[model samples]
Target: DAGITQSPRYKITETGRQVTLMCHQTWSHSYMFWYRQDLGHGLRLIYYSAAADITDKGEVPDGYVVSRSKTENFPLTLESATRSQTSVYFCASMGVAGDNEQFFGPGTRLTVL
Candidate 1:
């Protein structure tokens, strides 16, 4: 999967705490991604994985960590949460032949106090 990023529907955490948002897909897509949605920037890429154990940073990778040890799961971690990191996170997946087509999961809205 190369096109969709998904996560839980909602989350709330305090500043300086660690948070992990998990994304899961039933289909074994070749590419999976993580993105954050904010007021001015729309959706910005955070990280992406081409396959299990193969991950790369995206547009806004700072303060974030991602891992893909399984095709169905891509987890994004915030080592130490901050108020500026509060936003809606998305998880997406795309098949090999679906050019520019991605299946998106229900987004997670994280609020850091």
Candidate 2:
């Protein structure tokens, strides 16, 4: 089922540029998450969706946006890219039960200069 997939595994952009990262999952989980991994910050949640059309901001949501209109897809957009946003972004999902551990995608590495 390829459990989860992320597009443009690698990306590079200049400051102030706009970028979108795509994520897809075959499990059709009701919960999905977006996280970023960096040297100092480690892995921090950026946004999460409880279900289709129900989303919320996470620990670090500045300059970033997300949407989940389908149970299997969640896309993240960076309105204005910045060097600090250069990090590996991961998409994860969990069943609707709300108690299961999450399954993460391969991740997308992005760099802003």
Which residue ranges in model 1 land beyond 4 Å of their true spot? 1-7, 98-100
Model 2 regions lying over 4 Å from their true place:
none
TM-score of candidate 1 versus the correct structure, residues matched by position: 0.91
> Number of clashing pairs, model 1?
13
- The number of residue pairs in model 2 that clash at the backbone is 0
What is the per-residue lDDT of model 2 for residues 1-113, given as tens digits with 9 covering 90 to 100?
A: 57999998999999999999999999878889999999878899999999999999999999999998898999999999999999999999999665787999999999999
The clash count of every prediction, one per candidate, is 13, 0
**How do the residues 1-113 of candidate 1 rate in per-residue lDDT, one tens digit apiece?**
44344555788999999999989887788889898999999999999998899999999999999998899999999999999999999999877875747888889999999
